[model samples]
Target: MTAKDLESLLTIYKEVVEKIDLGIHVIDSNERTVIYNKKMREIEDMDIDDVLDKNVMDVFHFGPAEESTLLQVLNSGETIPNVKQTYSNNKGQEITTINHTFPIRENGVVIGAVEIAKDITKLEKMIQENVYKKGDTRYTFDQILGNSAALNEAIETSKRATRTTSSVLIVGEIGTGKELFAHSIHNGSSRADNAFLSQNCAALPDTLMETLLFGTAEQAGTEGRPGLFEQANGGTLLLDEIDSLSPALQTKLLKVIQEKKVQREGGTEDLFVDVRILATISEDPIDAIAAGKLRKDLYYRLSVVSIFIPPLRERKEDIDLLTSSFIEKYNHLFGMKVAFIDEEVKSYFQEYNWPGNIRELEHVIEGAMNLMGHEDTISFDHLPIQFRHKSSSSGGSNDLEKIEGLLYQPDKAILPLDDYIHEAETYYITKALQHHDFNVTKTAKALGMSRQNLQYRIRKYNIGKNTHS
Candidate 1:
């Protein structure tokens, strides 16, 4: 081609390259830049005049410590395809890109490399702030109901839990309102207005979970998107089912807690965050540790201020209050006018230990509300047959509870000791029988009494099945 024709072709190519959205860069055998297009300037957040004819690595390495893709290609004489690069440019702006680098060859002799990159920093920022948005928490301390001492103690612990940004470990069974406590703690903290994000450690696999909690450069490109910890910066992150987190994730979490910084899955920079982590596990800490699911050091770090929510069965005295609260909630939810609960229903509730805790109580009330026809009152017929027929506790526990209540009766002082003893024994035996679903063999075994002896007592006391249910 003629010199003028070649010059015209080169100018046209440069214009076309600069017009394209992707970044185009080239270097000669001496590692001096041959091309730095307009899009490359925008991507690096730098000026065109400063970058042209410069070493790509020197210009690209702002604060990033990892080796640059162009540097690797230049040294290895190999073509590197789809290399994810994370770096800050001369403008001090973080940049992420997928680079395709190829060695320029003359008759099979390696000369230089050409790098083509796509800026994904804008896309990542959009995803960080918009798509995977960190939202405001809708839960607070007022949502946790129950005035019983045991429940109150837990609430008070939550109150204290909210006073600091230290990591917390909430231990409770399923449906025990562990998430509520986490929310309350976050909302109560100094960072309440910032952001709140939760991740169920058990809900995701190790690879996905790592990217979600700590973020990854593979998908987000060089300057990757923020993970949950970064997203909840200056706020709180709730890690539910923490015991279910794989060993690898558990180790990363422990490192985050200890170092107060996180390294993304592919990025080299350690991003510091002011996020408070609140981890929850349904199983006991000891059990989780013994089972090798929860690391002991991680447990110690998370439980700097541990809070245990008592199960419904252990805090039976709170049932009446919780039931009333749930009744009101369901009333509004189901658009019902349940102004009162039948005393019979109350008796059934007090007797039926709730294994699912507050959540179960709410569900029961919801089911009852949905089942109610037009009555202004809730009755035994409204309750699920499961709640009515089955005792949440074992026969021995139900009988023991009955005996305790009997001992505390207001008129116990007036009754003769012998009569009181007989009355308590009869009441406990009946409860035992009921708890065992009227199975004489199971009830007798639970009470450590002979089946014949229990039957005799039942017949003598006239403990009919109808009398209990």
Candidate 2:
């Protein structure tokens, strides 16, 4: 190559090195600094005049006989692997940096040593914070609260899954606490000390998701962004609702999981990342794959540790526990003094088919607390009309016998449809009024009616004035 062309190439290379976020320094064979980058200057908080042509050891305050990785590399003419260290800047602020030193050669002869230092002060802080905050008590296996065989098996499976690095796939209906299981598994895993980053695949578009998961290169925009994989490195990544990922994005994600590397959009380099994958779906992944909504290969990869959270209705034994938990949560949040769910109200909750699962239960509890005001006990009066129907339909044999014995006898024929309807409405309205402390507004809303309408019905049915309001 011509000397002019070589000089131009060298200028471009130097400019590129100077602009990197990592500190770069070229030291002569004598172990003196020959060239240094802007990041090196900023890391030391120094002006060009203060650092130029200085011996590498002279710039920093190092103890005698305490050799640096750079010094060792220069002396042995060998490469030194990345070494993490703390150095004080000119402002006396200590920062963490990873340094790698290698011998620089010219004409096959070692002429100097080149060192690259990357500032990782923030990363170090995050690591320390994660280590110290290892035991977050937001959730536990006991929080699952179920005695059903299905639930017990699922919990056992989750416990087993936590011991491995295999990817997990959780499937359940909406509001079934799929995310809850994900959190429990992450907290139970060996990587509990690392960050647990979760993102719903259904929440973001393909383009945005790609950028969020794999980041963007410097050439893509002015500010380079780190992807979720990079941020969750050495941690767990929960991809909630993985079934919602488009086919194209599925291919990209498969590549990342398989290779454990990500090439940012518009960047040529592949970055290695270590992250445990946990994915969730509300639908049957096998059916979804058949329908072409999800990729088969991706499903197989994620199903290495599969778990299915049962809907609330299937685990009736846990209903009371979940109800009490929600009531406590809302009681503290809304400043309500509610202390218990009366048998009548608990019966209603247990009977209701919780299609929306635990999340729906939470909403129902919050709604009941709001309607019950500061009452110490939640009663059937606070339940909605649909819930009342469920209660009457599913209440124990004793409750059925009581209702039948009070209204009719075995010798009598079935009551007329209108009479039965009237009795049911009367029973629910009376119970609702009592639950709401006789507040017509709340009772009406719970029954999906207006105050005037409820009042008219109340007068027509000749219901008693047991309510105070």
List the candidates' TM-scores in order: 0.59, 0.56
- For model 2 the local lDDT of residue 68 reads 63
- Candidate 1, position 84, lDDT: 66
Local accuracy of candidate 2 as per-residue lDDT tens digits, 322-414: 888888888789878888888756756765677778887887777777778657998767755555555444543334354542346867667
Model 2 residue 408 CA deviation (Å) reads 28
In candidate 1, clashing pairs total 2
Compute the lDDT for candidate 1.
Answer: 0.77
Worst 10 residues of 2 by lDDT: 128-137
In model 1, which regions exceed 4 Å deviation?
1-135, 218-223, 392-469
The TM-score measured for candidate 1 stands at 0.59
Model 1, span 395-430: residue lDDT tens: 335465556435567865556778767777888887
